[model samples]
Target: MSSVPKALKYSKTHEWVREEDDTVIIGITDHAQTMLGDLVYVELPELEFSFEMGQECAVIESVKAAADIYCPISGEVVEINELLLDNPQLINEDPYGKGWLLRLRPFENDFKELLTAEQYTKLVASEAH
Candidate 1:
């Protein structure tokens, strides 16, 4: 089973979002890291770069293959995890903590469109079937 922290909102694509004041902290979920296997490299979006919801903003490459990381909402990137440049495997170790990908200042009022923990769990379970 994959770890899904209840405090975070999730995308069907496996990104996690944590609300913090006006900004949202983002990261790939444990399920994502598990699926990707051992990570080798991470391509994070530039700081201050703006992207639309569902846009492909970065890439994560593992020994198995490369996977695109998508934006969960329209926003401007406020910060990125520079440590990943040195050790991308932090994603596999602590995806919800030190492995966080980026922070974003949202363009909209609510992130209600994002999935709740229960919903995301169901979504992942359905995918397994």
Candidate 2:
């Protein structure tokens, strides 16, 4: 089973969002990283670049495949984890923590429409079958 932190919101595409003060941290889920197999590279969006919901904002390349990471919400990218440029392995190691891809200043704070931990868990289960 994949680790799905209850406090975060998840997208159907596998990205997770953790809300902070006026910003939200975004990253691929642990299940996503596991499926990707050892991350080799990451492509992050430019700071202050705005993206509409569902826009492909970044890319994650692993030994198995290169996956496009979509923006879970409409927002302006505020910060990116520069550490991933040198150590993409962090993603495979701690996806929900040190492996976070970027932080965004979302256009809004109401994330009720996104999937909860339970819903995401079910999604992952359904995909496995």
Candidate 3:
């Protein structure tokens, strides 16, 4: 089973969001990295670029395939994981921790509306069928 942190909100596209003081942290789920196989490269969004909710903001390339990473909420990208440029495998190692992708200053905390752990679990389960 994929590790879905109960504290984080998840997108249907498989990204996870963790709310901080005024900004939110983002990453692909454990399940995402597993499905992508061993990640080899990650193309991140420009720092300070603004993205709308559900917008494609980055690309993660793996031995298996390349997957697009989307913004879960409308926001300005305040920071990006530059280290991934040199070490994309960090995603496969610790996706919810050091593998985090970006930080966003959201227009609003609409992430509250995203799927919860239970909801996402069901979604993943349904997809497997």
Candidate 4:
């Protein structure tokens, strides 16, 4: 099973969202990284670029495949993890922490509509079937 932090919200596409002050941090969930295999590259969205909820805004490439990472909420990107440019393995090693992909200033508080950890866990289980 993947590590699903109870505090963060999740999306059907497997991105996790963490709210901090007025910004929201986004990253791929542990299950997503596991399925993709060892990460070799990360393509993050441009700073200040706005994306609607569910729009593909980034990409993560693993030895097995390249996956599109969707924005969990409509927002403008404010920050990105520069560390991933040099070492995408951080995503395979610690997906929730130093591997975080982007930080966004949300246009609205629609984050409340995202899935809870338990719901996401169930969704992952269903996908395995």
Give each model's whole-structure lDDT. 0.93, 0.94, 0.94, 0.94
Report how far residue 10 has shifted in candidate 4, in Å.
0.1
Model 4 lDDT on a 0 to 1 scale = 0.94
lDDT by residue (tens digit), candidate 2, 31-52 = 9999999999999999999998
Across 1-112, the per-residue lDDT of candidate 1 in tens digits comes to: 9988898899999999999998999999999999999999999999989999899988999999999999998899999999999999999999999999999999996588
TM-score of each: 0.97, 0.97, 0.97, 0.98
Off by over 4 Å in 1: none
Residue lDDT tens for model 3, 42-127: 99989999999989999999988999988898999999999999999999999999999999999986877699989999999998
What lDDT is reached at residue 28 by model 2? 94
Residue-by-residue lDDT tens digits, candidate 4, 1-129? 679999999999999999999999999999999999999998987899999999999999998899999899999999999999999999999999999999999999997779999999999999999
- Displacement of residue 60 (Cα, Å) in model 4 is 0.7
State how far residue 84 of model 3 sits from its true place (Å): 0.6
Q: Rank by lDDT, descending?
A: 2, 4, 3, 1
Alpha-carbon runs more than 4 Å astray in model 4: none
Candidate 2 ranges with C-alpha deviation above 4 Å: none
* lDDT minimum window of 10 residues, candidate 3: 108-117
Cα shift from native, residue 117, model 3 (Å): 0.8
